[model samples]
Target: MPSTLFGFTITDHKKVFAIALPMILSNIAAPMLGLVDTAIIGHLPDAIYLSAVAIGAMVVSFIYLLAVFLRMATTGYIAQSFGADNLAEQRQHFNHGLTLAIGLGIAIAIASPWIIDFSLWVVQPDAALIPYASTYIGIRLWSAPAALTILIALGVLLGRQQSGRAMWLAIITNAVNVMMDLVLIIGLDLNVAGAAWASLIADYVTALVGIYWCAKALNWTPALLKIIPDKLSQYLNVNGNIFIRSLVLQLCMATMTGYAARYGSDIVAVNAVLMQFLMLISLGLDGIAYSVEALAGAAKGQQQPERIRYWCKLTLVWSCIFAVFYSLIFWLFGAQIIGLITDLPEIINKAENYLPWIILLPLVGHWSYWFDGVYIGLSLSKGMRNTMILAAGFGFLPLWWAGMPLQNHGLWLALSGFLLMRGLFQALWLRLRWRQVV
Candidate 1:
């Protein structure tokens, strides 16, 4: 059945929503951790603590996201392996991805201090906020290896259509995080340290759950760990391409945060709130992309090019419809939404100015979000890497730099421009690369 523009097609509607629901619920919960932290800190004894957590969380995000290739690369390979019905090949991809994530996580943990020091240098956080940020990043950094390991293993499960388990894991983790946040932040008054600790502990618990589920789901054995030499090389090449792609994408985010930092803590708090809002939409939309990636990769592995087009069209239609709906909701409930997540009067006021930007993000951003899934599913990492790099470097940075002289609104405009630029470049890249097909 075809998906309708404004109504459900019995079969396709159920399929798409079934794929998206767990992801959407999990995505909503994921941002609540940050939002909960921010809301709690906003009501704390001072605003500095809130700002500190915001910066420290960004540092944490930057570090772990650097190895996001583990998840993205693993998903495609696993999907392809599934499509081919090659159980041995699937097990090899899963094991290799897990191995890479753990090794990368440990390496990051060892070098965390230097990474934090560099980030602090660039951000030059307030002295009062510095200690809080340090306490948070320092402790949270150790959780990297476990977090990545879980992420990669979950990606493998997701490739095999086990998103329900992944959804449950996230739900359990978020529920734990919320309970811990209240106990640590409000009950014990640990402030930023407490929030950080809650997150770290939650990740560790979730990772354990993921490890157990992974063993049960996969054909794990001594031999699968042996790793096929040529296939391993192909996995590395694909992962490397996606690593570069995600790095450029992360840089754009880190750079934007850097720019926000230049405006002071007040603006930083405002940026923090706005970022949380943006994350909610981005992560929610990512569900569709993820489903598409799995579907498309399976199609490619089976040499069914027509299925790729069908899945792409279905994903885009549903994603765009959601984007439109999200835009309207944001436009009408902008202030109320901000009000729910924060307590500080000034930051809430400042957030009003940024609400417009958040509202328009879905319309300007949904294509790139959906396109990323299509490419990942197709294992077109080279194309993904090239497009993101070109977009971030040539498109986003240049326009952002050009608007630097305007100060306040300039930064906001630059960010919006960057989003627009990414959407445009990715759209163009897709058209060019798949000219005959698209």
Candidate 2:
């Protein structure tokens, strides 16, 4: 009743839900929103539109992931500054982060045309698909500045525990996107490019909203503060490590997708559906993880060791409950859930066969999500990067190679094992070196 964990009063466990619930609810509704996008594409007469958009989205997402450090570093530094009650440092972090985001985003937009073309050429999907995918990607890249700027704003808000506003930011963007989808795709017959237009307009719109919220929340001063050389070095160090972690992750996933293609078209389709389910799970768990980053990071910044431990335990407790809830839903109604994506008997049957892995994934994988927040709170991403490298290089690749004979099933096994390894390594490092970092 007191939000106590083992005699330590958390002082605000309920606030964890206050933070996580909106995101969780957003996760629930997010699928339906995604369905609208899918349905629009599904109804289009030419299937090449779907393929074009998919390839373009995939390449852009993987490439833009390089900028994730903008959000993550902002969250870590801003949260600690909030806890320490250092308003100047918070403003400095915001100014620095915004500038960095805008700068990197512009670079991507200006320079990525050749990169996109080269990547597509390497993939060599089809002669017919080249023009369509190129057009979609070309328009989408121009929005990079606005998109990355929005990422910084969301990080600033979340670090200040303004998750409710962050949720609305996402909703407003998606709402505008769907409306544009209706207008351009259905009414105007823009087809594949319409989807790209919807996203482009929505990003710039939300970017404006993101800027407004950040300006008000952080409330910048009249005189802009310059980033310190020493401070920039430290920030880049953490950010660079995170970049390595992201690179390894994206490569492994790409490799997995490539292997999935080898099995057959249906297997490829089934893996795609299952990944949607995985995305849903990550979104839900990430809510609690976000809570940990804010609350525990505050505790660490305030030099309250007991509170840090308390927040960690409290969030873990809630994450486990949600993980169990998700597993049960996936287990009992796995077939029904698969049905939401496709009516084809063959794909449905194939997905259900592998549903067991999806159910177990949360149970094993939830640990890493929780600890990722813990390390982020400490602003120590080096551990995270190291552990991921080990997991990807040591756990996933070896297991995947050995299980090659099992084909798709082997791939799932390696993925599940890889996740479990990341959690264990992070936990062990924290246990052994907790005192030094904190």
Candidate 3:
């Protein structure tokens, strides 16, 4: 017989860790790749290389992250389907997600020239860095299809509780990216372009592997290709809300980077490194979020409010614990962490100055991360969308505007406020709609 604790099955903890740990490892690879990029470019003869890569990569990341709805929507739908024992619906959602991913990716690729021009215009990098940034984006934009395809595949695997497979895919992709970064950049003297090509190749390779795994997990059938309009409409609705939420968040990030650039390349370099710490922590918290998506969605499908509550309670507990752990690590090794990303004394000095914000980030930011998982798992996109809008508009913008006088310090303050308010607002919204969500 099954045992229970704290309104949860004794096995709940095992289920959560089983999904969360692999995802944490897999998600770490993402920022680890970014760190590798920074380290590679940071070593070049000039700081301009680092700045250009930072701006260029941020542009691409903003684009890809904006489309993150493709992954989030697929995960929610498939997890629900899995819980309801609707294998056919699971396969259908996967196909629909893959189709949308391919279409969106191709659209992005076709629009690259315009995107490149617009991004360059908006960022307005130093004249010396423009060519490098353009070259990197121009080459890298070609991988949009492969990158988005991998997103869809990862969503399918994760929603089905096959996180270990997703972990392998992440490992393979990051490993290839690292090896190619070394070979192409250091070995062949390709410079920033080498980094772009390395990422392009790795994305394509991972997409292929992910697609194969997805097929194996859900046997291929012609029926899978049949698109259902009602289902697609539902998918689009959820994805559309997520897109708005994500776009607002990305705008905040881009604005932060743009403001940092205005301060000078050293500030940009410092913030770039510091942002990695935030990214690392976010990814770690997101592991728990991913688990919430699966377990909570499953519970929702089964109409078990108690199970959902148990998941929320259990995951939130672990999320806070990890948040504290991250804060401690940053407090203890903050200097060494900065040193590993870049060797420039000036950049390292600036980063250490701002290290306190990074340390405070995990604590102030963890709640928003946890709420995001719960919202996604519950498929409560509208509430998520509304909270993000509130956070970004009322919470972030005014604070950021006021802090502009403080320069980078002001920027960090605004960012910290934005994160904290997102959580606060989410909590408020959840309280107001507790019955609907749970």
Candidate 4:
């Protein structure tokens, strides 16, 4: 038994690390891909190319993000099923999740034009970059199904405690993306269009490999899937919860980007670069959240409620520690860090002023990130979705509206408030689980 934190003993740190290490690697690879994309695009003759890439990437992230439920819901179901010692149930979870991923992927791909149009409207792309952004987004949209399906399949593997395979898949996928980006963007001089094509090709390749591994690793069978009564219903129920959560979350993000746009192209580009850096921090910390999801869900399914509670306490403590560490890092290296990514001295100067907000973001937002794992592990999808919607409406939108007249400083204030609001709202929601536990 581990020692207590506020009357709850922490679970095995080794266990947490076992799951988190590979996930951390995978998460790191994801942001590195973005950095590479930005790096390759940033070097182009015009900065507007990077801006186009930004809008294009944001469009995909916002629209396709709804399909994320595959991984999110699958992780919880598989974890709980593993804990329950229900191998068949575990298999069923994967099948249903994969099914949902494929279905949603197809639907989104078919409706890509509509989704792209809506996203363009939301972002309100400028005339200079609109054509470039549309071209990039249009090409990338074709890969939507492949990208989303792979995410869910990988999620199932992670839930089954096969984090190693997921990590390998992520590495291979991202590596291919980087190689293709270099070939298409720079070597071939295809510009933003090339970058989008690279992602599209990489996604299909990844999806194919992921499916092969999943079949081999799980020894998947139709009979195992048959064991699940109302499999489709269960999948929809779980997926619906996650869809709502991601939709609201993406809206908040899209709106934040919109706010940055209001400050003009220079601010948008600077913020986009800063956002890439912040992503590095957030995704790295998300390793803990990923581990907690699998471990806690498994514990819950096994009726080891104590284990779930213990892991939660342990992860939260470590997250706070990492937050402080990351803040110090940002403070110490802020100038050199921003300078490394771009030649635009003005953008770097503005980013320096905004660096403090970026540093503070992770620490304040850590709670929501950690609690996301807790909720996913417990399969409390509805509650998670509801809380996000509530937070976006009450906490974020209000502050954003109020700060509109204040310009850049006011913009930073609103965005900071948004991050802080998510933390505060989710913190309150986490306490509600006390009743669920006791």
Model 3 C-alpha lDDT per residue in residues 1-438, reported as the tens digit of each score? 688755557788789989999988877776577677668868978787778777788789878878888888888888778778888888889878888888888988899899999999987878898899998898878999999998898888888889999899888888888889899989998888888899899999999999889888888654568788888888889999999999899889878987887999889888888988987797779889998988888888778898788888998988998899999999999999989889999888888999889999999999999998888888889988999999998878998899988999999999999999999999999889989766
On TM-score, the candidate that comes out on top is: 2
Q: Write the per-residue lDDT of candidate 2 for residues 78-100, one digit (tens) a residue.
A: 88888999878888888777777
Number of clashes in every candidate structure?
A: 0, 0, 0, 0
* Clashing residue pairs for model 3: none
lDDT of each: 0.79, 0.84, 0.87, 0.79
- On lDDT, the candidate that comes out on top is 3
Model 4 gets an lDDT of: 0.79
Q: What residue runs in model 2 are displaced by over 4 Å at the alpha carbon?
A: 1-11, 221-225
RMSD of each: 3.6, 2.1, 3.1, 3.5
Residue 327 local lDDT, model 3: 96
lDDT of 3 at 37: 63
TM-score of 4: 0.86
Assess the local accuracy of residue 373 in candidate 4 as a C-alpha lDDT between 0 and 100. Answer: 86
lDDT of 1 by residue, 394-415 (tens): 7678777887886556766766
Instruction: Give TM-scores for every candidate, taking all chains together and pairing residue i with residue i.
Output: 0.85, 0.94, 0.88, 0.86
Candidate 4 stretches greater than 4 Å from native? 1-11, 33-55, 116-136, 179-197, 222-229, 435-438
